[model samples]
Target: MIPWVQLDSAKTPDGGQELRLKQRGAEFSIMLGTNELMNSRLSGSEEALAKLSCERIVGRSQPKILIGGLGMGFTLRAALAELGADAGITVAELVPAVVAWARGPMAALFDGCLDDPRVSVREADVGHIIRSDKAAWDAVLFDVDNGPEGIVYKGNDALYSAAGLGAARAALKPGGVLAVWSQGPDSGFARRLKQAGFVVDEVKTRANGKRGARHVIWIATLA
Candidate 1:
């Protein structure tokens, strides 16, 4: 049996928690305390977050996408695969080390997706990006945190708040979709999405192919 090796660690923006990256043989995982935020081998829901959102914006000319988190490049790679050359994606990763891990130890897992012409990576808060522009994205996918209320970072709660959802609405073009990945269902978040003028659809998915963790993806559309 192979033992897990800690490759590196980074402190959360609030400095209240730490994110640790570990590798076991060919597999990799990002952890917050005892909770594993993401694992290279379990990316089904993350890929679905991209695939589902891309499907909603098909055939749009020069579609723009904003991905909140760049965990192992799962969502970004999946979006790149589903979207056409006319589509562009901007990924905002809060922790700089997460981006570094994607280009460093987990580089092979990303498979050069970061270098794709349609993709742009930034080390910044997705929340801030949402508030920075108006009607800027065709699809905004959040592959960040545990859920609306994240355990890794205390500030993530604001991203799911009423005002935050409103900011997301203002940032999205009409009929654009906002796809969010969660470990499980949070009925309260769904209610908030509805209250924010979005037509929300909650979909269930697995962390891995037909197995692993049972996850949830909320595809909210701004009508």
Candidate 2:
């Protein structure tokens, strides 16, 4: 068995926690304390986040997508696979080091998706981008933090709060979709999505291509 090697570390924007990147041979993981935020070997749910959302807006001409996190670029790659050449995707990743890792040790895992002509990477909070735009995106996909209940950063709570959901709503075009990935189900979060004027559908998916632990994905669409 190959022992995990700590390749690098970065301080969260809030300075509340340190994110460590560990690699065991070809497998990679991004961890916060004892919690593993993401693993390269397990990307089924993350890929689904993009596939499911793109399914909803595939009919649109040149659809614009905003991805909250760029972990390993699984979601971005999946989105690129599902959408047409006219589609554009903007990814907002709060931690600059995560982006650096994708270009550094994890570059092979990304497979040059970051260099795609249709993709743009932003080193900023996804929440701020949501609030900054109004009805600008056709789909907003969030794979940030753990879920509505965040563990990596204290400030991430707002992205799942009522105000945050409202901002997300305002940032999407009519009939757009907001897809979220979670480790587990949160009925309260689903209800909050409804209260914020979205039709929510909860889907269950595995972390590792139908083998690992079941994860939750909320597909919320604006009527």
Candidate 3:
């Protein structure tokens, strides 16, 4: 069996936690304390987050999309694959090291998606991006933290709160989608999405293709 090797570490923006990159043979993982935030080998749900959201806005010409987290670049790559040449994707990654890892040890996993002409990477909080724009994005996808509970950084909990949902609603264009990925389901969060004036759809997806643990994806659309 191959042992996991630590490649690098970076402090969260809040400076309360550290994110470590570990590699075991060909597989890679980003860890926050003992919790594994993302793994290169298990990206099915992440990919689904982008695919399902983009499906909702595929008819729009040159759709503008905003991705909240860049975990392993799975969501970004999936979105790039689903959208046309004219579509634009803005990926807001809070931790600068995660972006650096994509260019470093995980470069092959990212597969040059960062260099795609249609994509722009921002080193800032996704919430700030959401609050700054008004009806700007056709789809807003979030794969931040361990769902809405915020395992890595406590500040991420705001992204799931009522105020956060309201900001997200304001950021989306009419009929736009807000897609979220979670390790498991939260009925309370689902209700919150509805309270925010979105038509919510809770989807169950597998973590690794057709196998492994089931994950949840919330597809919230504004009328």
Error in Å for residue 15 of model 1: 1.1
What tens digits encode model 2's per-residue C-alpha lDDT throughout 59-144?
Answer: 89999999999988999999999999999999999999999999999999999999999999999999999999999999999998
Model 2: lDDT to the true structure: 0.94
Candidate 1 residues 1-223, lDDT tens each? 9999999999999998899999999999899899888888988999999999999999999999999988889899999999889888999999999889988999999999999999999899999999998999999998788889967777888899999999999999989999999999999999999999999999999999899989999999977
What is the C-alpha RMSD, rounded to one decimal, of candidate 2? 0.7
| Candidate 1 global TM-score | 0.98
Model 1 worst lDDT window (10 residues): 149-158
Model 3: per-residue Cα lDDT over 34-121, one tens digit each? 9888888898999999999998997899899999988899899999999999999999999989899999999998888999999999
Query: TM-scores, in order shown?
Result: 0.98, 0.98, 0.98
Cα displacement (Å) at residue 100, model 2: 0.6
Clashing pairs in 3: none
Best candidate, lDDT: 2
**lDDT agreement with native, every candidate:** 0.92, 0.94, 0.93
The alpha-carbon deviation from the true structure for residue 146 of candidate 2, after best TM-score superposition, in angstroms, is 0.8
What clash pairs does model 2 have? none
TM-score of 2: 0.98
**RMSD in angstroms, all models?**
0.7, 0.7, 0.7
Candidate 2 vs 3: which has more lDDT = 2
